[model samples]
Target: MSAAGPSLIEFVAKRPWLKKALTPLASWYGNAAGYRQLGLRADDLIPEDNERNLQALSRLPPKEAYDRIYRIRRATQLSLQQKILPRNEWTKPEEDTPYLSPIIERLAAEEKERDQLDTLGVLKKH
Candidate 1:
């Protein structure tokens, strides 16, 4: 499982009406979370204390890694000053795309597969 825990994204997505109904709620929740005001993407809020996230961070492209670091540092600075980015400078909805999440999910899947393989047993021919 991902550090974020099991997600209902796939479940919601499979049903168009449910996804449509939840779209505004999700947007409102995202905005209310306030990370965008700090100029940070949702992915940046993910804790890096775990091995999977750390590995995923390491796999990010050079530009993406650099941008993530810059955003985090800037957010830290802004937080210390207790200020949010100007409205114009806040991260737009489109800009809040997931960069690290796919990698984390892939890593989790690989780990699960590895565990399954390691636990497999073969019977000897009689």
Candidate 2:
């Protein structure tokens, strides 16, 4: 999930044919991953132990933050009960979009830019 790693998504996305062919398989895999079954969005499963994820979580709107917490708590209760959410409560595909990823990417880009600036040396032409 780290931006530093090589991404199959990036590779596939570069080629239209590959992306088109894999779209359905990717959808199937997401469903197979089972997070949506518990009423949690895909972003909800992202590990929040990292600095970037923490920052992203902090940036979420108040309502979104509350919803995320509620979802996690509900999912935990369901897990203990050994039950999935009802069909109507499962996160739909359209609702499973990355809510935190954009923020994380923005933070990562800012961090990268800051690091670059920190190392920048001004060469004075005599």
Candidate 3:
């Protein structure tokens, strides 16, 4: 963090290839004792309370540098078609990459079906 906002580590700014390995940490440090006591799972994205910095940081991205951002953006776009999500509200563990597609598809399908039923004539008993 600096006068402007959370500055990207020099590693990220200088080395494009390192993007694959970089992860965005929600906090500045993890206290191992506290972490062990709390049993923290690693993959988490805190909501950006400082939305201005988030907006600025968006432009600095080597686009796919943050998988969570990429996934969230995709989900938001898909939600427009399916109506399954609010714009910024992403699934917990939003970067659970291997399972995200299936989860999104299932939810979106359910939402679409519900919307369809709302438009179509109702079922009496069946």
TM-score of each: 0.92, 0.93, 0.22
Off by over 4 Å in 2: 1-4
Per-residue alpha-carbon lDDT of model 2 for 7-115, expressed as tens digits?
Answer: 6877887899999999999999989998899999988988888888899999999999999999999999999999999899899999998888889999988999999
Q: Per-model C-alpha lDDT, please?
A: 0.94, 0.91, 0.44
Highest lDDT model number: 1
lDDT of 2: 0.91
lDDT of 1 by residue, 1-126 (tens): 346678897899999999999999999999999999999999899889989999999999999999999999999999999999999999999999999999998998999999999999998999
- In candidate 2, where is summed lDDT lowest over 10 consecutive residues? 1-10
Error of 1 at 76 (Å): 0.8
How high is the lDDT of residue 24 in model 3?
A: 37
**Models ranked on lDDT:** 1, 2, 3
In model 3, where do residues sit more than 4 Å from their true spots?
Answer: 1-45, 51-64, 83-126
What are the candidates' C-alpha RMSDs? 1.3, 1.5, 20.2
- 1 or 3, greater by TM-score: 1
